[model samples]
Target: MPGNETTHPLLQRFHEGDPAALGELSDRFSPALMGFAGRLLHEPFLAGDIVQDVYIKLWQRKGEYDSIEGIRKFLFVATRNACINQNEKYRLRQGQPPSSEDADPDEAMRKLILSEYLGLIYQIVAAMPDKLQQVFYLSFEEGLSPEDIAQQLDIPRQTIKNRKVEVYKALREGLKHYKVAMPILLKMLFPH
Candidate 1:
């Protein structure tokens, strides 16, 4: 980021399947993304997985990011979203999502537009059945192997695998709308 250090134009080439670009973007943003995820998850171990989830999403949808804001916002919003989504799902064992007043930001640069769409995704995830969503979030966002999640949760690993499959299917179906919306939203937002 310094004047002398060469920064790859990762935002440009990443969508084209450039691994080095992906690496560069990860390197550049990892600290901030990690911190954001950590804050949202309120757990260090889980936070690391959340950050990895961001990277995974980025890789899977590199072509989806219309701008740097798309990437940045997506990471932050998704982190918060995953946390809130899980919390809501858990609370529903009783009923209702937790009503935490999200602090207002003073600047747009402090947020990611990608997070907005991701938050929507999280809402969709939360609407899923409790056990299924829990398994999905644990494995998908936290990157726990099905076996590990099962060991930790005292559930069968096969159950975890089945839950993950269901979660992804639901997410793919729900977030399919973003494939069309992200670019259009980006064009409206940045006008570049």
Candidate 2:
């Protein structure tokens, strides 16, 4: 992680819509991401494939990136999730579940779901107006209080609350198609 330079170099390149940045990112972070995947997958070649697959996704989605996005966190989380998914799919295809090799399967699944959920959230937030998106993340993700958010962002507390409300309203309306068993009341709570 390079302070102020942006922790994820690939993300920076991806931000600029540079194909070469994707390659440079692969060269720089592949070693680390591959090593992490190898530990989880316990296969060198498969880990390499996993890293490749992760980069492939970045290449595909790079055009959507903007400067405000958190590239490093996104990469680490997405890679871990993709590796987990790939590993599980491979296991299922082989018609064999792990015997003694099983770690906490529930935890693994939770991680995968959480990672996907976060990625979806990022996509939604990124699609929002820049000020509203930043306010929402800082207030919710960073856990800043309304007063704190006002001070940090140099805005009125009421404005932050209104922005949050507007943001939630849009998400609820936008996600009306999802039948996730989540009650509609929760959407109202967003103040959006």
Candidate 3:
């Protein structure tokens, strides 16, 4: 339940041709995909269409993903490409110049991944103890230095630092059940 730990097994089931697994995957990722597509297309209905197309492609290319990570990456990448193609068609239809939105595929993927990552982090942080959650929001969301956070909260700088460490430790432990290594998760969470 914590951080999609079952994604691998679900994906494996999907690879084994279980239709229900595909449905589960769709239910899990459709909201995120819709949001990503909507952001790119600026049209809710078209975004839904794009996500539907992505699912159709997934079914067509069944058994292509060997890992949960691969499937996640593929879905976002395909959705982005589809969005770009849609944008190009719209521009041509309107007789307008194509926008630069799709110029960098890598950047788009990064944004999509980061969006999902932060959403997971937010869920985890929200479930944390109030004090620890405060520390987390101050340090990460508010972009405050430890010392600044300490001053703002009237806590010692050392306590603030300790709370930060505790927060990371809790996150690592909570996320470990999801099979994500701490170092990689930390790097993604705190990319600087």
Q: Which candidate is the best by TM-score?
A: 3
List TM-score per model, in order.
0.43, 0.46, 0.52
Clashes of 2: 3
Superposed by TM-score, candidate 3 places the C-alpha of residue 116 at a distance from the truth, in angstroms, of 8.9
* lDDT (tens digit, per residue) of candidate 1 on 102-142: 45443332334444554555555556787976775565556
| Model 3 alpha-carbon drift over 4 Å, by segment | 1-7, 100-192
Residue-wise C-alpha lDDT for candidate 3, range 7-46, written one tens digit per residue? 6678778888898988987876775576567656744469
Stretches of candidate 1 above 4 Å error?
A: 1-8, 89-192
What lDDT score belongs to each candidate, Candidate 1 first? 0.62, 0.62, 0.72
For candidate 2, lDDT tens digit of each residue in 1-192? 335444356656667678787776666455446545654563446877777777787777765654323444556666777766777777777886853234878876765654444444444555678787777667655667778888998989999888877777666665567544334434422333
User: lDDT-based ranking, best first?
Assistant: 3, 1, 2
Spell out the clash pairs found in candidate 2: 165-191, 165-192, 169-192
Model 3, residue 81: displacement in angstroms?
Answer: 0.8
The TM-score of candidate 2 is: 0.46
